[model samples]
Target: MSAIFNFQSLLTVILLLICTCAYIRSLAPSILDRNKTGLLGIFWKCARIESRLELQ
Candidate 1:
């Protein structure tokens, strides 16, 4: 029925949004660091680099 189809479409859209949000969340820290400075910035940079290295 039309309702079933609508439900399916809604589920697909919700899944896509969840995936996109997760991807963006993962990149947020690095993106925020583009204008970083001082010790906090240095710590974040170090943590980011270590994370990337660990990922491999």
Candidate 2:
């Protein structure tokens, strides 16, 4: 039970970190101008692509 709790807490922290990074990325001047190699960058690029598709 203790091990399970620890794992859950670690997962929550990891998710929170990702969300914070994404929020910062959104605030940048150009979301699509950044490198699209890392995990967050790739996700951001995909999101922008999808949004563009939806607008059309």
Candidate 3:
């Protein structure tokens, strides 16, 4: 019984670590953009925005 309990606790800890790591992995890109502009740069490069800017 105690061994089972220990196994369950270990499993829970491993699962928690995996979940937290996965969450961090998911967030890492948005959190640590090497370039300050990040996705905004993509929008600026689109032709529509450029033409709209030129029109204005």
- Give me the candidate number with maximum lDDT: 2
lDDT of 3 by residue, 1-56 (tens): 45346988777765555454445434564442343456644422332233444568
* Ranking of candidates on TM-score, top first: 2, 1, 3
lDDT of 2 at 5: 69
**Model 3 CA lDDT for position 48:** 29
Model 1 lDDT tens row, 1-56:
45337988777765555454445436785553553587545444544555565569
Root mean square deviation (Cα) for candidate 1: 11.0
Winner on lDDT (1 vs 2) = 2
CA shift at 51, candidate 1, in angstroms?
16
lDDT of 3 at 42: 40
Measured with C-alpha atoms, the lDDT of residue 8 in candidate 3 is 81
Each candidate structure's TM-score, on Cα atoms with residue i matched to residue i, is 0.42, 0.43, 0.42
For model 2, the superposed segments whose C-alpha errors exceed 4 Å read 1-5, 29-56
Q: When superposed on Cα atoms, how far off is each prediction in RMSD?
A: 11.0, 6.2, 16.8
Q: Any residue pairs clashing in model 2, and if so which?
A: none
Evaluation by lDDT, superior candidate among 1 and 3: 1
